[model samples]
Target chain A: MNYSNLFRIAIRALIRNKLRAFLTMLGIIIGVASVIAMLAIGEGSKQKMRGQISSMGTNMVMVMPNFQRRGGVSLGASSSMALKYTDVIALRNEAVDVGAVSPEIRASGQIIYSNKNTQTTIYGVSEEYLSIRKLEVLSGRVFNANETRSMAKVCILGQTVVENLFGKGADPVGLSIRIKNLPFLVIGVLKDKGESGMGQDQDDLILAPYTTVQRRLAAIDYINGIYASALSEEKSPAAIVEVEEILRRTHKLKESTENDFRVMSQSELLKTITSITDIMTYLLGAIAGISLLVGGIGIMNIMFVSVTERTREIGLRMSIGGRGKDIMKQFLAESIILSILGGVMGVVFGYLLARLAGSLMSSQAIVKTQSVVLAFIVCFVIGVFFGWYPARKAANLNPIDALRYE
Target chain B: MNTIIEIRNLRKDYHVGEVTVHALRGIDLKITEGEFVAIMGASGSGKSTMLNILGCLDKPTAGDYLLDGINVSSMEKDAIARLRNQKLGFVFQAYNLLARTTALENVELPLFYNPKVRARDRREAAIRALEAVGLTDRMHHMPNQLSGGQQQRVAIARSLVNDPVLILADEPTGNLDTRTSFEIMELFQNLNEKGRTIVYVTHEPDIAKFATRNVMFRDGKIYRESIVTERLNAKEILETLPVEVIEEFD
Candidate 1:
């Protein structure tokens, strides 16, 4: 028999019992839709992370002190004060891959401006800190070497701190604000940088010269951390190695002694976060695939019932010169059409659902073309795999007995 | 006359567990083209079995059965199906019309299995077959929408659509009223008069009286075979019966 005839006949048969056919397709629709939605959300989060990391400067590296042990009791890494200004200088002088280096220290305190006081983090760094962290000064200037030598109480306010201390549209440049009873001059206001992928507010801090914060405010001589930038994105790995060696030599660590400082590049963090999201995507896809398998079983179940109900019809066709293969083809075509119809509908619904989720979560949920193609291929395979048994049963039936069947 | 069907020493046995039931025993029969032969036997007398074997729906255990000079008794399943499609037509007692299908499509079913027929030619042939049974006006009606005699005519139209060498009907009029049965018999008589070979099986002697000859089967063997001395005309008998008053609203 020609395929057109078989397709026409199969379509007619399905249309006869419209409700049952749709119910059979429901399983497949849900299976494919869930797969698309889940993958889109997972892929969207990974993309968001990559964007966040790249925005923070993919060539930048951060060095933090390792954990400190006091009387055999281990303290957290934040308590370790091994990172020093001399280590930053050594990194700048010895490391050829290192482009710019800045010592960093942080303190949290209340800043007051004409009775409007707001609590915020205070970052202490050098003139190169803005370039190393890719931050731009909106107005005025950063602290110079003369201010650093005199331990001048000069600071730059982030957008969040500026808005909190001095309302919107008010330029705080060349204005003075109090930091925990110590008056500090605001030389500039940093431009706004939105929330990171981790949902942490990026513009909720203040920046000042590291010598000013260490000597004038905290009465400390050592620094908390260091920030450095490589010349290019690809050189960050080598830059990390060079910085580690410089720190190791400055700390006077022996060959067997463990280093007291840790160096981390932006791409290394990207790899760790991306790998986690990949596992989650794989897990969600696997769960959705199980539903597809259940959907396939549903198709098989309906096909079996259809074959049994149409035994006499099969026998009649056989008597009229329809071969066994013809019968098999007709039933197989019916199931494949059913699945492909469901697959097409699923793709449409999946896209709509992904868009809805994206809006609801305020993130970009992209439905990839590869996922749509994969789901359709899976549907075709399921149709054939589940349809084979029932079609075979119909084909192998004896015409005499089938005609005699009630 | 050319022989349309020839069978010698046909035997059919059914195995039920350890015992073999002999359904047909050493039967010999021959039917010529343009002949209306009725095989009469009660249930379990092997008439149904013989009809099935003759229609190529079943194979004989031991026999030399030939249709249109082709030996088909020992043919394979697919070959038998092709031969049946090419040379044999079937009319069942149940009418066997696809319930939800229109009369024209039901008639066109047999042509779908014939690879030689194209789409346009198939439709034309199906229309002609419906016209032959005088169902041209009701060609689009479903089987459930028509009366018993009308449905049987549609079945007859389906059988005629293929233009086969022989028409094998088993109890074709078994489920009809007396007048409807006679009406179908008249249609069969009209077709037979047009040089069609017909082999019908029936237990009702009253229904078998329209055939030119009768073969009586008893316990899987032909007990008697004789040509009718005075055959009844179905059209004449139907005219004598009272007119059937069908519901007018439908």
Candidate 2:
């Protein structure tokens, strides 16, 4: 028999019992919709995290001193003096992949301006800090290289620090603030940076020249850490390797000795976040796939009942001239049509569900084209798999016995 | 006349819980083209079994059966199905028309199984077959809307749509009234006069007189075979029957 005729006949048979056919498709519709919606939400959250991380800085790598041991007692990274100014200078000069390098010194003190005092951490960095960390001067200019070299007592105020010391919308440029009881002139005010993924208020700090902090406020000789930016994200790993090579040689650490410094790139943090999201996506997909399996079983159950109900009709067709293959094709076509129709409806509903979920969660839910195609293919395969046994049973019926059936 | 069906020593056995039931025992029959043959028997006489074997719905245990010179007993299931499509037409006692379908679509059913019939040709052929059964005006009516006799006529039209070499009717008028039975028989006679071969199975001796030949079965074997020396014309009999008159109150 021709395919078109067989298809027509199958459709007619399904239409004969409209309520039963729709009931059979309901499971599949719900199954495909949940699968699509879950995957979209998972993918959306992952993308949102990536966007948050990128806003902090692009391709920024942090070099910190490892834990130091004194008299068999472990001192944390901040107490260690393993990283020095010379190592930072060597990394900036020797590493080709490094775009900008800044040495950092950390201190926390009370900043007082016009009787409004606030306690905040102050970071002493070089002039390259603005470009490497992607910080913008909102109102005034940043400290020049000459000011950093001359050890000028100039500082930059973060948005939170400006608000805390001089009230909201205050520009602290050319204003004096005391840190560690020493007066410092505000050179610039940075743009607001909101909060980091770890719940740290990013706009709650201050910036000063490393030389000024090391020589005047903290009275320190060795630097605490170094920050460098790679030319691009792809070159981050290579830049880390170059930084490690330069730092180990500059510190005069032998090949057998373990290095006292560590180089970490933004890509490492990205890897951790992506892996977590990947697990979440798979977990959601697997749960949704179980419902699809149940839907397939529902199809199988309906097909079995249909075959039993139509035994007499099958016998009549066989007697008239239909082969076993034709009977099988007719039944299989009914199931496939049901699943494909359900799949189409499911995709539309799933898209709407994802959009609704995205708005409620304040995240962007993206429905990937690949997920839609794969879900359809999966539904088609399920139809064939579940439809096979019942169709085969229908085909194997004895016409004489079937015709005699009541 | 060309021989349309030939059987020699045909035998059928049914195993009912380890007991052998002989359905057909050594039956030899020959039916030629353009002949209207009636097979008469009781319920257990195995006439239905013979009809099933002739219809290619069942295979005989040991026999050589030929339909239109082809050895159907030795053919596989699919091959026999193909042969049935090309050679045989069947009308059941229950008038097995598909429910919820127009008479035209029910008649078009058989043509869909024939690969050689195009869609447009199938519709045209179905219409022609319905016209032959005098159902042209009711072609688009659903089976449920049609009378028992009209539904049987639709079944007949369906059987003839494929233009088979032989038409098989199993008590075609079993579910109809006397007037409707005579009307169907008249249609059969009209088709038979046009050179269409027919094989009919029934238990009514009165109904058997309409056929040109009669074969009687007793206990899985043919007991009597004879040509009807005097045939009954269904149209003439229908005219002689009293007709009910409805009174007009208006």
Candidate 3:
């Protein structure tokens, strides 16, 4: 018989027991739906991370003191204080790929403004720091080269710091705030930068000239870190290499000695984060695939039961000229129809579920076309793989024995 | 009359575990078109086995069997299946109509396996077969909705739908009441009179009397063979029986 006729017969048979058919399809539906939703959520979170990192400036690079071993005792990067203003000047002047460079020295202390006080970190940087870290001055100007050279007591307050010290939406430009009991003039209020991918608030700090923080507040000579930006995103790796070489040369490290500073680019961080999320996505997809395997088994179980139930009908068909292959094809068609229908429904259900979960989680859940296509191909293979044994059993049944079966 | 079935030394053996039981030891039979023959025997006397072999449902242990001039004894499973579809029809005692299917579809089933018949032609042939069995009015009813006699008639229509060279009926009336059995037999007789060949299998002597020829089996061998001198007409028998009153509940 033709395929159309076979499908018609298979459909009619399934319709005879609607509840059973639907129940069998339920397994496949749940399997495919979970796979789609899980993959979408994983992809969404990864994309969100990349977007946050890109906002931090795709070409941005950081040079921090490496963990130093002094007399077999390890001191972390924070306490090393190995970076210096000279290293920043060297990178700015010598590294062609480096677009901008800034030396950073931070001090955490209480700031008192008009009898209101809050604890926050004060980052000492130059005008280039704002551009490198994608910070913007909302009201006034940033600390320029003369201010950095003269150790001028001027600061730029982040939005959160501004709100905390000067009240919500308050313009604190030209205001004087006391930090570590020393008076500092606020030249500008930085625009809102929200939060980072690490869930840290980005707009909760104060910016000042590196010379002012080193001399006035902490009384330190060495800087904590150095931040720079590449001329373009594509030049970030080259910029990082240039910065590393300049720092190693300025530190006067021997040929066999490891550099005292570590250099990293924003794209590297993005890659690390996305790779982790990729693993999570596949792990989730594999877990969901177990359910699909179970669904395939469900199809096999139902097909076997159906074949047994219709033994006499098979015999009758055989007597009327149905070949073994015809009987096998009929049963296989029934299972394939069940699985493929479930797969289609699952794709729709998964897309909706992903959207719902995405909105609930306040993130975008992406449903890739490849995932849907893969689900369909998997469902088809599942249909055939699971439907084979039972169909063969039906085909191999002796016509006489089957007819005589009660 | 064309010879529709010819068998020589047909033997069928059944192996129950390591023990072998000879179901049909050695048998020779010939049936031609337009002849109504009944092969009758007691239970376990090999009548069923003989019918199975003749219908090509079972391959004999050693024998040559031909149906409509084609050697079917050594044919492969698929070839035999095609031959059965092309040249044979079957009516079982249980009616064997697919449950939940309309009588018309059940009748159309045999034609479904015939590649030569299109969907439209299949339906038309099924309708004609139902008309021949005088079940045209009940064609749309499911098998469960039809009475035993009507259900049997639908089965007869299914068997005739393919227009095969031979129709095999295994205890066609075994499940029916006497009146219904006679009605089905009358339908068979009517079809036979229209030049359709039939092979009927039953242990009932009265049922066997409806056929033109009777072959009896004892153990696994044919014990007796004879042409019916006084053939019993099912229509006359059915006419003499009391009418069944089907009560209608309002």
Candidate 4:
């Protein structure tokens, strides 16, 4: 038979039993929808992670002091911790495309101003620290090098500290606040930085001159870590190499020995975060695919039942000169049509579901076009692959026996 | 007269586990063009087996059966189907009208199988077939809407659609009342009188009396053969004969 005649017969047969045909297609619908929805969700999380990491200033490197502890008691690594004030100065002088490098000294203390009091972290660094960390001075300026040398009693307050200490809508510039029993003048109110991917608060700190923390808070000359920025996020590896060579030479570590400190660029941290998210997506999509396989099996079962039920009709057709291939082609075409229709509908619904989830998150839902296309193609393939056996059985039936069958 | 169908020492067998049942016992027969014949037999006498083999639906165990002088016993199934669609027409006891289809479409089916029949030509020929069967007014009605006799008329119309020279009717009118059976027989008699060759099977003596020649089978072989020179007309037999079929012709 020609294609149109076979198609006409298939359509008429399917329409004759609309409810059964719709039920048969439901499995394919669920399979396609889940595939699209799962992939979209996985892709969504990936983009979200990348965005969060990018929020942290890119191209920046974290240099922590390689502190050693013996017997659970702390002993400062003065020799191994080469990210010092001298190294910071050398970075500014020698390195090209090096934007800003600051030695960080942090101490936790309570600040008192009038009736308002709050306990927070106080980070002391050079004037370049604000620009490197992308922190803005909302109302005042960061302290200059003269302030660091003279050990000026100047500090910068984060948005949250300013709100708590001086009340809302009040500026704390040029005001004195006591930190760890040391009196300091507030030089600026830093800009508000949002939360990180690890859910740490970014706008709850205090900044002051590096020397002030050494003299008044820790009573030591050692630094905790160094925060260095590259000219651009894309220029991170070059900046990392420059920092490593300078720190290695400053520490004077011998050849064939592991470096005392771990230097992590922003890009490395971003990749680690992305890999974890991508794996989660894979796990979720795999679970969805298992259900899709179950759905394909469901189609097979329904097709077998259909063949058994239509046995007499099959015989009649065969007796009327319908060939085995004709019957097989008609049934297979019906199944493929049902699956493809279900897949198209599923893609539409899956995108809607993903969009709903994203709306609840106050973010845009991303529907990967490739995933939708793949879902449709897989549905068609599954229908043809699984539907062939039952159709073949219907075709191979003996006309004489089948006609006499009850 | 040219022999349209020639069967030479045809035999057919069936296997049930290890037992081989010989369904056709080396039967040789030749049917001339435009000859009306009746094949009669008791239950399990293998008449159905002969009919199936004659219709080219099943192959004989070892024989050469030729249709229109072409060897058909050994041809593959598709070729046999093509031959049947072109040369053979069937009328079974059940009428076998498609339940969901109209009388016209039912008649059109065999022509649809004939690749030589174009779509418009098929419709015209099917209309003519239905008119010849006296079912022109009921052409659009579904099979369920028609009586047993009318449905059988539709089946006859379907058989005539392809202009097949040989018409094979296996126990036609078996399920009908005596009056309806005679009416169907009259339709077949009229068709035969118009020079269409027909082969029919029957157990009733009254139905067999309608044929010009008779062949009786017992134990998978033809036991008796006769020519009824003064055959009873199926229409006259319906009017004069008793409502209950007489069994004396046995």
Candidate 5:
């Protein structure tokens, strides 16, 4: 028989039992949809993370302290033996590609006055710190460069801090708040930056000049860490190299001595997160793919049952000048048509589900076109591979015996 | 060599559990061209088995069977199918026409296997075959839409489509009344007059009267042979049968 006739016969036979055929296709539909949706969600999260990090300025880099060994003892970053505040001055003056440098001194405390006390984070840095960290003041005013030089007691509060310290009724500008019993006047209230993509509160801190923190509280001229902005995103790696060299030279370190700080660009952080998300996507896709395999086995089982159910019809066809290969071709065509139809429908349904999920959250629809193509290819292969044995069994039936069957 | 069918010492065995039932026991027979013959027997007397072997639908366990000068006993299964398609036609008792296919398509089925016949030619030939069996008006109707006699007529049309060397029919009129049975027999006679070889298997002696030759089987063997000493028409044969038998059959 020609391929068209085989296809026609197979399709007609399948359509004869509409409910069973539909039930059989349901397995394939579920399998394909699961695989598509899972891959899309995982890929969507990765994309969102990359977008958030990149928006924070690719030129931004972080410098954290590392352990230093005096004899043979090793320690961690919090050991107070690594980075220093003087390193920022050295990087700012000597590093060619550095644009701004600021030191961060952090301490958690409560500000209290007249029965109003609120817990908050206090950060210490220079006035250029606002520009370096991409923070903008919404009210009052930021401290000037001279204010930072003179170890002034001026401070800037973020939106959350202003809300907590002064409430909506009270004015925050020029108000005094006791910090560890040392009063400082609030010079500015920062803009409502809201939450970052990682769910960290961006407007929840109080910023004081670094000189005041060093002298009044810690009583040392050292810093916790440094934040530096590159001249441009394209020059970040060069700026990191320039800053590292300047610090090493000012510290008078030998060639054999290891640096006591870790310098990392924003892009490197983005890469680290992308690798993690990539692994997660693959793992979820694999788990969903197993259902596709199970769906294939279900098809095979039903096809075998179909062969047995129609043995007499098969014999009749064989007797009426049909070849064994014709029988084989008919059954194989039937299963392939079933799976391909299911795969096509599953792609549409999967996209609908993904779009619904994205819209419910007011987010972008995560449609990955490759997943549609990939799901179809895998399902088609499954049809052929799972359908072969049953088709062969039908083809190999004994014509005489089958004709004799009732 | 003029014989269209020749069987020598044909044997067929059926093993059901430990019991061995010999379905065909060393039967020897030869049917020449252009002869109408009948084999009559009681149930389980192997007349059906002989018809199956003659139609090439089954293989005999020990046999030397020749069909149109080819040794069918040694042919492979697929080659036997091809031989049946090319040289033999069968009309079954149950009128086993494909239920969902139209009469014209049913007649054209064997011709579909014969690719030498183009699609248009096959259609025309199927129409002509149906006309020859007096079913020209029912050509487009499915089997269930046709009566028992009309369905049998469609089957006869199918048997004639390929123009085989011989036709083997098993109980062709088994499901029909006396009037319809005679109508079919008349069609068979007319085809035989056109020089087609025909064999019909039956158990009713009166039905066997239509053929010029009769072979009766008993206990897996041909136990009697008889030629019609005097020709009898179907009406006359029905007229001679006892009224009790007719009433019981009705």
Candidate 6:
């Protein structure tokens, strides 16, 4: 028989028992829907992470003091005090790949502006620090070279710091805020940077000249860390190497001695985070795949039952001149139609479900065209794979016995 | 008349585990176009086996059979199926109509397997077959909705839809009342009078008397073969039967 006729016969048979047919399709629907939604959610989170990491600063590099070992007992990196202002000056003067360099010395203290007092970290950095860390001044001016050379008591307040001191949406530029009982002028209010991927608030610190923080607040000679930026993202690795070489020479470390500082690039961090999210995506997809396999088994189970239930009808068809292949094709068509229909509905349902879940989680879930196409191809394969054996069983039935079956 | 079925020493064996039961030891039969023959036998007399072999539903253990001039004894399953579709029709005792399908579609089934008949032609042929069986008015009703006699008539229409060389009925009236049985037999006779060949199996002597010839089987062999000297006219018998009453409800 022609395909159209076969499909008609199959459809008519399914329609004869609507409830059973629907129940059979439900398994496939749930399977495809979960696969699509899971993949979409996984993909969405991956994209979100990439965006957050890139936002920190393009081509950024960080140099920190390495852990110092004293009699086999290691002191943590933060207590080493290896990175210094001279090493930052050496990188700035000698490195070509590194575009900007700024030493950071952190000091935590209570900031008082009138009656409002909030405890926050103060970052001692040069004027180039704003560009290297991708921070923008909303109003007023940043600390210039003259300010850093003169150890000016001028600070740039982050959006979070400003909100805590003067309230939300209040620009505190040109106002004096007391830190460690030392009144410092707020030179600028930095723009909001939101939260980082690790859920840390990016805009909850203050920026000042490294000279002033080292002498007045922290009373430290060596800087805590150094932040640098490459000329472009592609040169981040070269910039890290250049910064490490400059720091080693300034520290007068011998060629055989191990370096006392750690240099890390933002791209390396991006790669690590991307690999983690990729693993998560595959794990979600595999769990969803199991449900799809169960759905295929469901189709096989129903098809077998249908064959057994319609034994006499099969015999009648065979007697009327239907070949074994014809009977097989008719039943196969029924299952294929069921799964394909379920697949179409599942694609639509999955898209909607992903959107709903995305809103609930406050994240955007992306549904790619490839996932939909894959779901369809998988559905078709599932139909044929699960449908073949049962159809063959129906075809192989002896006409006489089937007809005689009660 | 053209010979539609010719069998030579047809044999059928059944293997029930280690036991071998000879269902049909050896039987030779010949049936021609425009003839009505009834094969009558008790249970296990091999009449059913013979019918199965004749319908090409079963392959004989050893035999040379020709159906409508074609050698069918050694044909493959698929080839025999095609031959059956093109040259044979069948009416079963159970009326074997698909449930939830209209009588018209059930009648159209035989023609569905015939590639030579287009969809439109298939429907027209089914309609003509239903008309021939005098069930044109009930053609739209489902098998369950129709009376037993009407259902049998629909089955007969299905057999005739392909316009085959032979029509085989296995106890076509086995599930019907006496009056309904006569009515079905009368319909068969009417079709036979139009030059359509027919073969039926039955154990009831009265039912076998409706055919022009009778072949009785015993012990897996033909016990007797004879022409009916006093053939019963089913139309006359149906006329003599009391008319069925239709009850009215308030």
Best by DockQ: 3
Tens digit per residue, CA lDDT, model 4, A42-110: 788678768877767777887886666669876665544445677777777877867888889888989
- The list of candidate 3 runs beyond 4 A from truth reads A70-72, A76-79, A114-116, A166-168, B247-250
For candidate 2, give the lDDT of residue A402.
82
> What are the per-residue Cα lDDT tens digits for candidate 2 across A1-406?
9889999999988988899999998889889998999999999988887877888675999998888777998877454788889878788778999989999999888899878899998899988888887888899888888998899989999999999999999887998889988899998999998777656898999999999888887787888889999889999999999899888888888999887878898888888988999899889989998998898899999999999988988988998999999999999999998888888888888999999999998888888999999889998998899999999999999998887788
Clashing pairs in 3: none
Give the candidate number with the greatest TM-score.
Answer: 3
Error of 1 at A24 (Å): 0.5
Q: Taking the candidates in order, what DockQ does each have?
A: 0.74, 0.70, 0.87, 0.27, 0.31, 0.82
Candidate 6, residues B12-70, lDDT tens digits: the string is 99999999999998888898889999999999999999999899999999988999999
Whose DockQ is higher: candidate 1's or candidate 6's? 6
The order by descending DockQ is 3, 6, 1, 2, 5, 4
Of candidate 4 chain B, the 10-residue stretch with the lowest lDDT total is B241-250
lDDT of 5 at B239: 63
**A83-141 in candidate 6: lDDT tens per residue?**
77888888889999988999999999999999989999999998889899888999999
Ten residues in sequence with the least summed lDDT for candidate 6 chain A: A75-84
Candidate 4 wrong stretches, greater than 4 Å: A66-82, A109-122, A125-195, A199-220, A232-234, A361-363, B1-4, B32-38, B84-215, B225-250
Cα-lDDT of candidate 5: 0.81
Better model by TM-score: candidate 2 vs candidate 3: 3
| Residue A55's lDDT in candidate 6 | 86
Query: For model 1, how does the per-residue alpha-carbon lDDT over B1-250 read when each residue is reduced to its tens digit?
Result: 9999999999999999999999999999999999999999889999999999999888989989999999997688788888878798999998888778889999999898888898779889999999999989998888889998899999898988889999989899999988889989999999999999999999999989999999999899998998987899999987888887877324
Instruction: Write model 5 residue lDDT over B128-205, tens digit each, in one string.
Output: 999999988888887878888889999898888888899888899999987778878888988988999999998888
Question: How high a TM-score does candidate 4 get?
Answer: 0.82
**Cα lDDT tens digits for candidate 5, A273-322:** 89998999899889989988888888999999988988876776666666
Per-model TM values vs. the true structure: 0.95, 0.89, 0.95, 0.82, 0.79, 0.95
Order of models, best TM-score first: 3, 6, 1, 2, 4, 5
Q: Candidate 2, residues B37-57: lDDT per residue as tens digits?
A: 999999999999999999999
Chain A TM-score across all models, in listed order: 0.95, 0.86, 0.95, 0.89, 0.88, 0.95
Candidate 1 on A19-89: residue-level lDDT in tens? 99999999999898888888898888889888987888889999988887779988764448787788988
Cα DockQ of the candidate 5 complex:
0.31
Docking class of 5: acceptable
Which segments of model 1 are wrong by more than 4 Å?
A68-72, A75-79, A139-141, A167-171, B248-250
